[model samples]
Target: MVSIAQGTFRTVLLTPEGRLLDCRASSVLLPSHDGMIGILRNHAPMLCELQKGIIQVKNIPDRKNAYYLIDGGFARISLNHLTILAYEVITFEGMDREQAERTAALAKESVATKGSFVSNFDEEIDPDRAAFIVKLAHLSEIGND
Candidate 1:
């Protein structure tokens, strides 16, 4: 339960520094510019641009969602082949729970702080991702204490 139904498909996620994910999945759910798009076996081939959001994958059966923060990118699906080439991609697996909590706390604090200290900050953070991190910390699952 750790891969697709044995098909020849590839999803490539590229980050600014390097490639993040280049693997095969049973199904790939991506956050498109308009909304989310689901790709399955023999999906129609097409190319599209994506926005900042999560890319959920159902690689292993009955497994939890695999989340990734993508800044922006283009998605190309051709004849059952899918490729997600992005400029920046951050995987939840690579995230440090302690660091996430610290950053989340800092972000919450910065929201109340007024001054040039908050000059450069992301205006809107994804609530889903935030909630996931909070839940992960609460569950102490990713070595969060």
Candidate 2:
């Protein structure tokens, strides 16, 4: 395995709503459909479907390591530029730790409620989605702090 520890790349994270993050990073780790994949500058061109999880941007020029929770999407990597087109994004921009904690609490409650309510035999809470939400909440709390 090759180790990528130097250089930078342009990273753009967007959703149907709007652009959530646009920055240059030294490295980025995203949750792919299969598992976590890390991208570094001059990486080989590739495209993959993203999973519901956290996206970590590391070694930014002018900010702390940033994190975003994505529901699902696709990532395109080419020529040292990585673009992420996500379906939904949960951000902690300007959110305080207290607020994030509350959001996490609400997410837990939602998961519990959905799991307990079994209305319509064909409809039930998706375990993957629920787990994703829980993970998102946890990430948000960490990011806010």
Could you give candidate 2's per-residue lDDT for residues 32-133 as a string of tens digits? 999999998889999999988889888999887788877789999999889999975766666676666665555566577665322122233354555554
- 45-91, model 1: which lDDT tens digit per residue? 79999987667766634445466767778999986667788864545
Once model 2 is optimally superposed onto the true structure by TM-score, how far is the C-alpha of residue 42 displaced, in angstroms?
A: 1.0
Taken over the whole model, the C-alpha lDDT of each candidate is 0.62, 0.75
TM-score of each predicted structure versus truth: 0.63, 0.76
The 10-residue segment with the lowest total lDDT in model 2: 116-125
* Cα deviation of 128, candidate 2, in Å: 4.9
lDDT, residue 20, candidate 1: 68
Which number leads on lDDT?
A: 2
Number of backbone collisions per candidate, in order?
1, 0
Cα displacement (angstroms), candidate 2, residue 126, comes to 7.1
Off by more than 4 A, model 1: 1-8, 60-65, 104-145
Cα displacement (angstroms), candidate 2, residue 140, comes to 4.6
- Look at candidate 1 and tell me the lDDT of residue 123: 38
